[model samples]
Target: MTDTVADVTPEIAPSSYDAAQRRSDAIWQKIESDPSGLRMLTGDRPTGALHIGHYFGSLRNRVRLQQAGVETWVIVADYQVITDREILGDIQGSVRELLTDYLAVGIDPERATIFTHSAVPALNQLMLPFLSLVTQPELERNPTVKAELAAAGKSAMGGLMLTYPVHQAADILFCHGNLVPVGKDQLPHIEQTRVIARRFNERYAGGEEYFPEPDALLSESPTILGLDGENKMSKSLGNTVMLRMDEAETLKKIKKAKTDADRQITYDPEDRPEVANLLTIAAQSTGRTPEDIAEEIGDRGAGTLKIFTAEALNAHLAPLRARRAELEQDPGYLMQVLRTGNERANAEADETLQRVREFMGMVY
Candidate 1:
C-alpha cells in the first residue's frame, strides 16, 4: 500500500525488489492521476478456475482499471495453459470454467476486451521474431521460469515452455500494454517482458521505441494465501475458495479451512498463516485491514474467526456467484463475448504486427 510493497519472496534479490517496487509506484501514481490513457494487459492462463488468490492478486485490479476507462485487455491464455501437458489434457473444460470466473468477477464484456490467446494469431506471430531477440541463457536466467518449472515439478521442459515469457512479451506488446497489473511473483516475468521489448526496439527499431515497456502494477491487496495457509491459494493445489462458489459451499469450505488453535486471533502471516489468511480475506471482503480485522475480532476463538471469515467471504462472492450462474446457463453468450473480444483484440494485434513486420523487414 505504501512505497514499500514488501517482496514476500525471500529468494528475490533486494535490488530487483527495489527497482520493481519503485517502477510500480511510478506506474500506479501515473495511472491514478490519469487512467484514461493507460492501456492495461492482465489475465489468467485458464489452467483452472480462478480462486480468491486470483481475485485479490490481479483480477480485482483488472476490473478497477477497466471501470476507470483504461484500455483494458484480459486474456484467457489458452496457449499458456498447455505449458504443462497435464493442463493440455483438460484445457477445454478449464477454458469454460475460466470464462465463467471472468464474467462472474465483473469483467464487463463491453468494457474490457477478454479473448482467448489462440484466437489472436497476429499476436502469436510476434513471438517468432521475439524468440530470436532473446537468448537461451536469458530465458534460463528468468526466476519466473525457475519458479514455474519448480511448481510444475518438471526438471525437463520443452523449447516453448522455456520461452513462454517471450510469448508473454508478445501478448503485452501486441496490445501496447503500458500497465501490466500483477502480483510480486509475476514481476520477474514482466521484467523479462521489459527486456524483450527493449531488445526488440534496439535491434529492429534502432531503439526508437515501438512497444511500450510494460510496468508491473502491484495490487493494493497483499498476496492472498490458500486455506492450507502454507502456499498460495491455487486451484491446481485444491486449496482455493473458487471465485464462483455458492454461498453455502463457500462457507463450508472456509469452515474447513485450516486455522490456528489460538483462542485470540492475531494477524501474523509469518507466524500464523491460517489466522492471517482469514484476516486478510475478511479485510478484502470488508474493505478493512488485516490488523483492523484482528483488532475487531479480539479475544475471538478460531470458531468465531471462521464464522466471520465465511460470512465476509460469502457476502463478497454472493453477487459474483449469481452472475456466474447466469452466464453458465448461457454458454453461447459466453462464447460470443470471447468472439467479440477476439475481433477487437485481433484488430490491435494486426496493427502491432504490421509495425513489427515493417521493422523486421518482413513486409514483403
Candidate 2:
C-alpha cells in the first residue's frame, strides 16, 4: 500500500489532471489493493464544541489510526445538523470549530482530509439513489433512528432522521471507505452500510464489487459518561468537559462533578455509577484499570479521587490545549488546512461518483 500520495509533475503528467487528482487516484488504488490499509470515514454533527466524550470515544482512535498510516477522512456532518434545524444558525461556525478540534487533537491535515458535508455535494446527492436500495422496515429497525426519536420525545420522526443510516451509508460508500471508527451503538449503522454496499453492487454492477464493505474500528476506551454521570456526555446537555478547556476550567468541572457520597471509592459501575465513572476516566487518562486506580488511591475520598483525576486529565490535555491555542491564533492557516483537505476529499469522491454513474448506466 502506498503511504504517500504520488508525486505529479505537470510537464510529464497527464495534461487533464493536477497534482491533487493524481494523488487521489493513487490513494484510491492503494485502498483497493491493500488488506491492512484502512480508508476511514467518520464524523460528528457540527452542533458545538467537541467534548471529552468525542475525544475518548472517537478522536483518540482516529489519531492512532492516522499515525499508523491509515488514509483517514474526517467529515464534519454539517448537513445532518438540519435534522433538528434549530441549530442552523451556527452550522458554519460549528464546522470551523470542528476542524479546529480535529487539528488540536493531532489529526494531521497532511495525513488526513478533514472536510465539511456542505463541501461535498456529489457525495450528498448519492444519498437519493442509495436510499432506494434499503427498505422502510430496515430503516425503522435501526437503533440509532429509534434512539434519536426517543431523545426528541416524538412519536413521529422526520424522513431524514428515520433514514439517517442510509445517509451514513452514503457517507462511507461515497468515499469508498473500508473502515469506520465507531462506538458499539453505531454498529448498526456500519451493518446498514455493508448491506447497502452489497445491494448497490448486486443491483447496478453484477459479478464484481463496486463498493467496499466497511468494517467497524471499535474504540477501546470506556464509554465516556457526562459530568452529570447519568447519560452519555453531550454538549447540548451542558454536561460535557470541552476538549479545549483550560486546566483551571477542567479542574473546576471535575472538582464540582457529582460522585457517590460513600466514603470509600470502588469500581462498581452498576451500584456506584458516579464514583465508577470517575474511576473510568482516571483509568482511561492513565492507561490503567479502574480497579487498579481505585486500589492505588485506596480509602481516598471522592475529593482526592477528583483531584487525582483532574491532574491526570490536565496532564494529558495540556499539550492539546497548547496546540489548539497556537492553531486558533491563525485562522487563515486553519482555513487553508481545511480547504486543502476538502479539495482532496472532493477529488476522491468525484472519482467514485463517476464509477457509480457508469455502473448504473448514467454515463453520458
lDDT of 1 by residue, 1-364 (tens): 1101112342568797788889888877777788766888877776667788878776777777777778878888888766756536687788888888888888888888888889899999998888988888989987777766776678897777788788888888898888887766677778888888898889999878888788887767787788888887766567888887777888888888898768987888889988998898999898888898888789978888889988998888888888888988999988898889999999999998998888989888
Clashing pairs in 1: none
Cα lDDT over the full model 2: 0.77
Model 2 lDDT per residue over 280-335, tens place: 88888888889998987888799999999999999988899999999888999988
Candidate 1 segments whose C-alpha is farther than 4 A from its true place:
1-10
**Could you tell me how far off, in angstroms, the CA of residue 156 lies in candidate 1 after the best superposition?**
1.6
Q: Total clashing residue pairs per candidate?
A: 0, 0
lDDT of each: 0.80, 0.77
TM-score, candidate number 2: 0.88
Over all chains combined, what TM-score does candidate 1 have? 0.93
RMSD of each: 3.4, 10.8
Candidate No. with top TM-score = 1
